[model samples]
Target: MHRPAVHRRDPRLEIITEAVERLIPRATPAHLTVTVTETLPGTANPDGTPHKHTWTGKPEGLAVKVFTALFGRPRTEEQRSPLAQAEDAKRARDLVGELDALLAGGVALETAPWYPCRPGDLVHVHHRAVGDVPLTPAFGETYIVGDAGDGLMSMQLLAHTLPDTVEHAADMVGCFAAEAADCPVYEVWFEAGAHLLTVVRDGRPVHVGGAR
Candidate 1:
């Protein structure tokens, strides 16, 4: 009887073969040749939501396709419209003004008197059944106002690096609450390594922190 010639496989090839076997248990060495194709960007779907990718082939290709689907492509600055950019700028400006008014004595926490920084804008606080207190902004810091909801508004401190004290965080919350007497409550979000402060207003934030 003639013995068939035994073929030797490279050790590195064997390692890869083992990995492939683990990846696709049902596949054999004969099924190793597979074609993978990726779709170009801007491919549309039936519903009009762009089809992110068109990955075809074996299990490995499927894995790549799944990842691409989960984390879509990042948007470039050029992708944003000019109108959208302008809207963002306007929002930032408004937030800055609100922050400045809150930081300065523009917003009044008490019933004494308050004046608007700009003409045609109403900035007054309604008197509520709460105690009035004076609060002041921290020295040499910039803040940005975020969303206001549930009688609470959020403010974030802006700094090149993290804040160095919990005292500034507390002072910010206190000052915000004092300015907005009607808001009864204020929340402050500071930078990393800093603390959060919650201020329950005895008066509205509008009353204490007179609006601009």
Candidate 2:
């Protein structure tokens, strides 16, 4: 029997990278060095795009120990339960497996920064938390609103003390209407439980309303 081809690139790595990036600033100690390693002879990505893998710097079967060493053990007993611990261990093992597979495929691993958003660039928001209104952006004198699941009309005004600030529906109609208004503003919207905001000309997001 012939064996099917194995996928070289894993999409879960992206999620891990994003999560690690977000948590590193807060969770990791400043003194510790974080590195990503990849196996040699990289392979092609599923989407036909170039891809890289992050190395955990730990040998196979030791990922859980490495993860615990870096992040520390769970604080509460509830989180340290057998099932919870198993989940964490599984995550570590999966990460290691993915990295090993990528390296075997000749995928080059390199260090990279996690950039959630950049100015003047279109970004896709992926919100993990649920709320009525997740993201809001302000331009010049107007506001761009994004509603996650709640109705547009029920959206709340973000805390801002600027003049001529108005809330536009999260939909295209509202976004375009705001853009058409005399007041200049960046377009903002939410999708897939995340907030998507258009960056302004300046190298900064117009404004992220509500506590990030």
Residue 23 CA displacement from its true place in model 1, Å = 1.9
| Candidate 2 lDDT over residue span 167-189, tens digit each | 44233122222212221221222
Q: Candidate 1 residues 10-124, lDDT tens each?
A: 1122122234434544444334434455555778789976566443354333433443465442222222222333345567786654454343221212211221121112222
| TM-score, cand. 2 | 0.19
Most accurate candidate by TM-score: 2
- Cα lDDT over the full model 1: 0.30
For candidate 2, give the lDDT of residue 118. Answer: 26
lDDT of each: 0.30, 0.30
lDDT of 1 at 196: 19
